[model samples]
Target chain A: MTAHPDQTKAGAGRIVISVDAMGGDHGAATVVAGIAHSAKKNPDIGFILHGRRDELERLVAKRRHLADCTEIRDAPDVVSMDDKPSHVMRHGKGTSMWSALESVRNGEATVCVSCGNTGALMMMSVLRLRRLPGIYRPAIAVMWPSRNPQGFNVLLDGGADIRADAKDLMQYALMGTSYARNGFGVARPRIGLLNVGTEEHKGRAELREAHDLIAANAQTSDFEFVGFVEGRDLPGDTCDVIVTDGFTGNVALKTGEGTATMIAERLRDAFAYSPLSRLASVLAYTSLQRLKKRIDPRRVNGGVFLGLNGTVVKSHGAADPTGVSAAVKLAFQLAQSGFSQKLAARVASAALPPQDASSDDDGGTS
Target chain B: MTAHPDQTKAGAGRIVISVDAMGGDHGAATVVAGIAHSAKKNPDIGFILHGRRDELERLVAKRRHLADCTEIRDAPDVVSMDDKPSHVMRHGKGTSMWSALESVRNGEATVCVSCGNTGALMMMSVLRLRRLPGIYRPAIAVMWPSRNPQGFNVLLDGGADIRADAKDLMQYALMGTSYARNGFGVARPRIGLLNVGTEEHKGRAELREAHDLIAANAQTSDFEFVGFVEGRDLPGDTCDVIVTDGFTGNVALKTGEGTATMIAERLRDAFAYSPLSRLASVLAYTSLQRLKKRIDPRRVNGGVFLGLNGTVVKSHGAADPTGVSAAVKLAFQLAQSGFSQKLAARVASAALPPQDASSDDDGGTS
Candidate 1:
């Protein structure tokens, strides 16, 4: 696959985002609406929607103004969220996700966005675009909801590698730091290893080894190593970046997300319980909106799979048009900012010598 | 290190819970108050409080009614929560926590409960009590908050084994199941492995293997296997028992506790901001109390560390008198039920022929 820098014939700025239209619960309607909304706001952006021709046409026909900014490519197969990663890759020949990812690989689009099976999207992206040299496993980096919107924590391998060694953890730190710096414009991002305690030699064997490797690495010295952080610290803006194996990270991320949603649902149910409560809810509309904005997943929809050669953003499966639009904007920001290129350089520089590597390998025994 | 069934004279048919009175933030005062409160309600319960001579006498003098049910044992040192686990064990001979556990080990008390440094407690307990004949690593089993009052989920290895393989997971399942059946009085507990998905091959290699082993083993087969469960299912009473390694389990448990507290704090702050809101809160005091009862951590304070030869419960460090009282009651219930003995018999009988013969081998890798 070659990187081709192409200019759109429609006279929009040369960047194009290939979206898996058939992905997520809402399917093509959400992607089409989100694209139309984003294109109207940012006239420089264009989209290539990949899905079944009939459904794509029907969704597009509902929005006449989007005809100029949007185009559809036929990709009949759809990958469900429950599908196995290998199954998706093996059977998803002309699937929307496959085509969307291929568009990024072929440089027809600057970035690819999907709200499909996260594992499948990750596998397909790494398989299609290939990993950057020395990057054994690509990581999925997410911005967790924090008390300070200006400072969000980055967590990688959200569901990628089951068991990661110290070397993988170091790579995650490097990639996550580079992402925070380039994508979010944070300077000298403070990196932390997620553990039960902050003390040295506190966590599992791999974390202990990773701690030593991170402390000794000269290249990572440019970024701040803030030692260990607990689960409570993730929401407090204690560190700009926190790294862990995919299993723990995924559980923590999902737990946070589910808890937020559960609380919101409970509040809604509480308000609907009585007429007096409903009136009080109306009276407290402003305060409620402030709370909503604080916990809104839409405000943090895009989760970038860092360490991959090409840019791939995974949005929430249940995201509406607004969330999808935000995801697209975030993807564009990451791609245009050259986040991947910067991360590649940082990881290359941080690579440890083979002799020193022996001390860090814990046999991936998580 | 012989197991002494009678180290102290039986003072009535009551169960004595040895408490490290100097363990938590509130010190001997809270422990004395909790013991007094529990003793007032349950005349059959007694407490052996361990702490410094001066502080113990000072606190005990204030509560005259406690003299009938409580006895103070002086210990020279106090183990700070921040102290390293290994260092604390090496130098904790006369510490309050050490003395408390010693009381249980010598059969002076039926159970030992602490709200102190968890790592130090685990180290001391394992060193003093020793593991069960076949048990490799002891696991901490906690009751996860569920929708049904009678239905509570068990999470094992809550912060014990940082690195666990298939065998560890299997042991956690077996031990947790036994706890649910004995502690919760469930006829046959339904066990669910905490994983990202319900598919057979969803989790890491260890989980996959553990799932197969549990399905094949007759001891585990008696209990209903509900398959995989996510973090969201924890509060919904989807399973009778939930199992995972310590690292993930600890994070999930703490995250739930912290998030719930954070939300409650936010609500209180919101209500306290205005006189009118404060008045409204006052008017809704009864309803608020009901809500508090629904989510009270005090209702579930004691977390039993299963896979041991005897019952040992770890209480929350921040627990109040009410929480401490609940922990003491729970410890008494576990001992009276004879859960650990029955569990040992079941585990021994269900093991493979070779496993039964070689059960004494200590260093075998799981």
Candidate 2:
């Protein structure tokens, strides 16, 4: 995003972010605090907070600068984290999540930010904003902290749908590349297909065909196809975007997060093991804080929906104010760069090969 | 295993482990050193070391106890890590990996432990030892360090074969439970079917059917069924066995390992960031070392082949002496407990559901 963070003046030029304020674990107050944090950091951002008017207005009024740049939309209902997507789709009329996405659908907001039930939010997103042309499944791309110079890599299909075939995988490659380009300003992104091994003969049959298909499209797509990458490469510097089906991608994403959290916990325990260690921890506190900042999940908190007509950032349902603020910053950046439109344009320009409307032809591996 | 550590006598009642000394990253010396380490700790373990005669003799002779408990089996060939499984199956009759499995096939050794190529070892294992009757796919179940009472969880298939259906996953559950019972002494182990979500409505179609099938057979199989666990649960104390297809399992395994390695690296960098941290590192050495000992990959470094007539342990290709010793220790435990016969008996007695011979019926998710 070329938008500078210093532009504190709020008015018509501000990029509007539609937020579903009712669904997060900490309630609307936390969401309002997150909005306030973003408003304090970046001057050229505005928000349409969707929730109960009295509560949201009271929260927003506490932050005068936030009040100057924010409008509260009255959404009487709330989408609980446990609500089924089917249930939500059937009777999700005045819910805050729906109201937030509707703002994007009606062109009243550049993007929508929600910390609701992921499945329900995604379902409502497809129903309201719609999938792009020639796209079998829309994917949710999350920024994974990596060893890359950009400090993060784009991993797609973070659980938009459980299954993806050869054609769907190929579409993911295109969308992921476009995401890296627009979101991080990477000139020419490198793409890798996630598999069991880097060998061509390995993995299931669909992955092999996807490998060939992705490699074949590399030249025209204007991205370097790094053939195949194992799960280890997800956090490594081998590629800018790692693509896979939602089942595998979601599992890997959570596995990585869980491992990181476990290690951090262990490190904390190690520091607290003895009096000497505790003293050492106090002495090394600054460095530990620095390390914590580098690997903090809250620092990179949004999973942006790709292949949809409009962009939506799915913040973690349990996110605190800092996490929410980071997600808002991401939404602001994507809106500033017009990520959704460019992604749509990229997919339209480079249509994937039609091998399997259903990937039933690959009988051997899957 | 109930094997006593103090029974270091090399004569009668000794359990012989077949070792492939030709194929690890380090030479036969390291393999011999690992054997010596095991011998130093446990006296009732014997070895049939497969490699070149002269080198094995020289390395074995350096440690008198290891030399006394070991017999050299001269196999003229070596299986490089890059050798294809199919190629090794056809032309690898006299290779050390081939020779190592034959010992188990002929009942000369209680179990086989190899630091050779995993795919080749698995191929040779199936051809030589054969799969247990009624078992469709032989899986490689790995021990993942976790917060379980046993300090680890069993995850399979660790890339034995990429695709697994509802039936395959059911078999994995059976095999994994048996493994936990024998390998970790976890009686009536809890089995979790890996999925995108814990909700029954989530994940691939095969997983849902597998969930039902595994749930139904839990009581008969004598194990607790924890339905639908996500990737994060692998490290948690929720279950003792995590069952999934080879592709997902393999990816999760490597992804977890990679995350650990990256964090460890960052911690090192963090400690080295400044003079104060360096001094703090010195002060916290013992606590840090204790933490390292708890999470070291080498401490739990074996992928046990399940559902085979004979047990086989595939050590990592780049494993060091500590890693090799860990694999040897696991092999010893399995061998002492007659894990192979018990697993075969368990599978033959409690059969899987009859959904799909090839899982072709599930059209929705793969």
Candidate 3:
């Protein structure tokens, strides 16, 4: 679906993003501050801030530029982190999250951004915006800070659905490649199927089948299929888009983040261990700060929900103004570029013919 | 089976480890150097070195201690890295890898350690030593360098079977907990079921079933069940043993190692960026070295094959002398403690009762 018909006449007009300014761990103030930060940086960005009208007006009034470009919607309810997705789908009406997504669904906004419960956000987005045609599942693609030249790798489904079959994995490849191109500007993204080992015969039978399917479609899909890649390859420079089922991708993402955090903490403690080390820390302060910034999780804080009719960016619930702003920036970029429409077209074109039992051998060559 | 029945009277005597000095990427020299390194540190360790006699004798002759402690077996053929397990099982006779495991099968050594083809070694071990009773699928358990007090966590099955059912995961729990207790001396080891989310409602159905199975038998199995732990917990201080199906565990293990290595290289490059950073490098050299040693992959360099009738340690194919030595140390520790027999008893004790059609609901309380 395209944006408002009136806005289409202006080639470089403002893009409005619906924001759910409630349910974040840091409260509504942090979310508003994030929007203010984005508004100051991007002149063409506009927002439909959904939350309590009085609070939204007060926060926006504090930032003149944000107030000029913002519209307030009065939504009384908030989605708690513990709310069940099913419960949210069934009874979560009039909530800020719901109203924000409804803006995207009704052509009022180009993209929807939320710093709320991920499960509830995903559930509400799918229920309100719906899935794309021929797309069985909607995957959440995350940007993993990586050794690639682009400094990141796209990994999905990052906890959207716990399972993916050969067909689903092929669909993920199409969606992830589309995201990598639109989201990261990688002209020819390298798509890799995440397996236990890079070898052809190492993983499950389904993976082998998926490999063939992905390899068979790589040319038409306009992506390079790097065949199979191992877990260690995720943060390495081997592939641009590391495709896996949601279960494995989610686990790998959190594990990598946890390990990086632990090591950073240990390095900090090591620098403070002795007088000489402390002196070294002072000398290495600039370089260490640079390295820290390069690897910081806050720099890339959103997980984009793909394979859906509307684009949804789920920011970390505990995100500060900087982190939330980073997410809003991504949502704004995607919305401006019409990423949802492009992704839908890619998925539709890449959709394989219905398979019987015998055509499985077609995905053999990469 | 007791080792060298004739030496039974000695009681607290030396332990012999079967060594397959072939199929490693570093060649036979690295394996020999690894043995020599282990022999220098340990007085009560002996080896049954399996390889070509001429090459073995020449290498052992250079190290007096290794020559004194090693019993060389003349095995001309070598198991190639490309050899399939089924092929090896049928026609891999007279190979160094086969002879090495035969030592353990014949009770000549307490444990078998190999730097050979993983698939071939797994097949040969199961064929030669057989599976422990009540163990349907054998698993490869790796020691993951972690932030735990023990400095590592035991994760399995690390590519044993790409597919593990509920019963297999439960077995992995028993086997992993047993390994953590005996290998790391983590008394009353905390066992966690690896899942996408920590919540009871997340992940595949089998994980839920395994969670119930593990939790229900924790007291009897003598492990502290930590409910569901996410991938982040793999390197965090949450659990001692993280249990998952072979596929997930393998991917997670490699992913952690890969991410750690990439970061280490990036950190090193950051320190060497400029003259000021170079000077900072010298200042932080000692502390950085300590941090490097704390997270070095070489320190914990072996994947122990669990749930089998005999103990087998698979060293990294590209390991250097130091890496190989770490694996030897692990093999020596397991041999000294008679870990294989203890594991057998644990498996037998934790064996599930015969399931009726309706009583399969036992694994649901957690």
Worst 10 residues of 2 chain B by lDDT: B357-366
Docking class of 2: medium
The C-alpha lDDT values of all candidates are 0.74, 0.84, 0.83
Can you list the residue pairs that collide in candidate 3? A212-A363
CAPRI grade, predicted model 1: acceptable
TM-score of each: 0.86, 0.90, 0.90
- The i-RMS of every model, in angstroms, reads 2.9, 1.0, 1.2
In candidate 3, what are the lDDT values of residues B182-213, reduced to their tens digit?
66678899988899767787778988898888
Off by over 4 Å in 3: A1-14, A24-30, A33-44, A52-69, A318-321, A354-366, B1-13, B55-65, B351-366
Clash tally for model 2: 2
Better structure of 1 and 2 per lDDT: 2
Pull out the clashing pairs in model 1.
none
lDDT of 2 at A115: 88
Tens-digit lDDT track of model 2 for B163-231: 898878988988898888866788889999999878888777888899998998899899999899989
Candidate 3 B-chain TM-score: 0.90
**CA lDDT, candidate 3, residue B101:** 94
- Candidates 1 and 3: which is better by TM-score? 3
- Screening candidate 2 with a backbone cut-off below 3 angstroms (N, C-alpha, C), the clashing residue pairs are A8-A43, B8-B43
Supply DockQ values for each candidate: 0.29, 0.66, 0.66
- Model 1: per-residue lDDT, tens digit, A1-366? 112346553225546778898779787788788878887887666678899999988888787677776778899999987888889878988789999998887778878998887788888887887776656667888886665456357788777766689978887887887788877878788888889777676778889999977767634447888888887666666788888888888777766665566556656666665666666566556656666765666777778887667889998777899888888888778767776677767666665668634433332221
